[model samples]
Target: MESNSSPSSSPIPIFSTFTSPFEGSSKKSDLTKKPLSLWPGMYHSPVTLALWETRSNIFERLLDPPLDAPPQTELITKTPSRSRMTIMYNFSTDYLLREQYRDPWNEVRIGKLLEDLDALAGTISVKHCSDDDSTTRPLYLVTASVDKMVLKKPISVDVDLNIVGAVTWVGRSSIEIQLDVTQPATADATDSVALTANFIFVARDYKTGKAAPVNRLIPETEREKSLYEAAETRNQLRKRKFKDEKKELDNGEVDKFEELLAEGRIFCDMPALADRDSILLRDTRLENSLICQPQQRNIHGRIFGGFLMHRAFELAFSTAYTFAGMMPSFLEVDHVDFLRPVDVGNFLRFKSCVLYTECENPDHPLIHVEVVAHVTRPEFRSSEVSNRFYFTFTVRPEAKAMNNGRRIRKVVPATEEEAHRIVERMDADSL
Candidate 1:
């Protein structure tokens, strides 16, 4: 299948409902109001759909057996290098930004970028495992994690985005795809790397719902060797983290707050601390819930990871905007862990909060936002946490100065465990 020859020129309607999930008798004051114009374009934009369609075509080619292949062959075999894919999109200012904003790039637009990345990564995963030629027994792939995302600079609307994804490592069922986002050199600026991220995906048999094997990734070039080695290191770190989490659960060690406090770390009631330190986690939190629709499903009949990322980003942006009292520029997406796949028609609840904030000067403030996604069954009303996303943003100096150097509110952890988690995240961000 070929991608759309011409993308529609008209603007598309936003499909998401940007509203507070919390129910209350009293309305939030203007000081905490969400920006009315904070809208995402990926869900309904024709250009976005066209780009995704092109990606889908690539995926189809990767999975489909060659026409000349023997009819009796049960498995379709292809080299890993043949699975590599690249996509480029020319986004107009109107396509990405709200009409109220002068600049096209902002936290909301960054969310859209992340959404596209997730989609592309998921497609690559399916391609990597397409050796199975059984049409009736399809393979399903879901995003396992997104890590080591480095945002070199803010993406402007004036430049077209170039996204490249290639397989770097493959496990029995999991594969790592390194994605690089760049823009062509322009008259005003040289070609630059906008973002780089490593996305992990796991393949499963659609019928049995069990782990499926994928072709190994053989590195031939020196650059490929380095990427493969880096992926190995990251995989080790993920294992250690998972083991530690399991141990914590087994030991029933729920709170680490008291442990930090006992170690002479002052979590609260310090007058020397900045005024922003007094802000509670609840003060800068926001929640949004929606039912998954069929349109949001991928080829496997499950919710697309990119769609979930887009929704999560919007909530995080809202939380940061409400706390900072201004639009924030997206700096980095520290990590996103997808614990499990979400099925279509499941109700998803997104809870986002300002985890921490650092302000050295009134000119620039860094805000760390955490978002947790939960999937609930409509009948039982029981929910399981499905994903966790960490993002960093900075308030522009001009925006901060205009607000009279408004101090970005800090997250006040209610317990020692929460404090320790905050510190760990802070350290991770530094790396």
Candidate 2:
């Protein structure tokens, strides 16, 4: 996507939204809520550190550019300086809970950013920082446009990013935040991995639970203007993309699934109201025929491991729940890999089937499911499986609340090396 300027670049200044409890001057301005409280432990390492980098970098790279106009160029005049800030401190990721690495959320990242903002706003303090000036409350919001992909072991795909965020029009309730993320290619890389987005955060005072006005005017800075332009360009591209995708969907060109199903095993089984339906889905024909579309052609043009897993999980759930007649609990999802990139318009196929289970523990019979999704282009119809995951599900026989009633296992996977290995691992994990 081309980097261009966005219209929402003006920055406002800060003003009070609440009457101090110590001073009873209760003239309510347009400010809606009390400033957030200064709390201990809120701005500690890891979370706070990530927040600091995310916010500071995003602000300097994104906001500063759009808010300020570029210096007028003259034949003899030199170009103007850009707004810039060096890294003052870096925090390790140790403070973040290990479980967070498994299921990361956008809100979690935002919370950390806000915590750092609270410290910068004079509502809080970093424990070890020497600079304790309590008067500076910086204005801006931070966000990420994540296009994640599941990868095979040992290899890593770094998300090289150029972030652009600016304080949009400030208001009584909030300041609109617009951001654009550009993932750059490395020295040896041939293509860019990127996504752009925008966010708006309303400043709130913790005491009154209301909105606060942003009156802080951002000084004109070259960095801010450049970032804003980038955002505008990204926005326009996104709009054009939506139109194109709509056209593709309307054409009824569902190419991948129908072809793969021809060569794959299909299952349509339903048992009485058993809550766990995973054990009965023993159809695995699509695994051998799956293929991954390359990144160049995918609509987003980026292969996100998480997005691929989500699709796999959705298909697994759809197949399993249809047979078991209950909401299946997501017991575990392990061994996810992005074997390849699935591009847009490429024919993609997915296959899911139960592996095996031990009847020794009757209530929770471990169910193993395998998935393979791949892509095939028009020129080269050679399909390759690009994604894989092993999912485990158990039956909840006691759940009468299940709408579909208790489901009982009707079939099991034929014993195989992978099947035996899965059961053995499940047995060990239970210990």
Q: Which one wins on TM-score?
A: 1
Tens digits of per-residue lDDT, candidate 2, 1-431, equal 22333322122112111322224445564143332222111223322333333333332322122323332122121111111111111112322232232223211222222222222222111111111122332222211122121111111122212233434323343333433323345565544433222333344332233443334334345665665455456446545844763342222223322322222222323334332433323443333233334422211233423345556766665554554455444455553434554554556677776544444565555555566676756587586867665665555565424544443454433333333444444443353
lDDT of each: 0.65, 0.36
- TM-score, candidate 1, is 0.75
Give residue 380's lDDT in candidate 1 (0 to 100): 93
- Candidates' TM-scores? 0.75, 0.33
- What are the root-mean-square deviations of the candidates from the true structure over C-alphas? 11.4, 19.8
Cand. 1 Cα-lDDT: 0.65
The segments of candidate 2 whose C-alpha lies over 4 angstroms from its true place after superposition are 1-300, 397-407, 410-431
Supply the global lDDT for candidate 2: 0.36
Candidate that would win on lDDT = 1
Q: Give, for candidate 1, the lowest lDDT window spanning 10 residues.
A: 1-10
Tell me the tens digit of each residue's lDDT in model 1 across 1-431.
01122232121222222222222426556246432222221233333343444443444433342434432224444433555666655444334333221244532266667776777677666666655454344466778888857677666655456677778888777889887877765565564667888888887665466787766677766777888888899899889876765333222223434443332233355535535344766567799999988677665566778888888887888888888898887777777888888887898999998888887765667889999999988699698999988988888888877888777765666666566667667656775
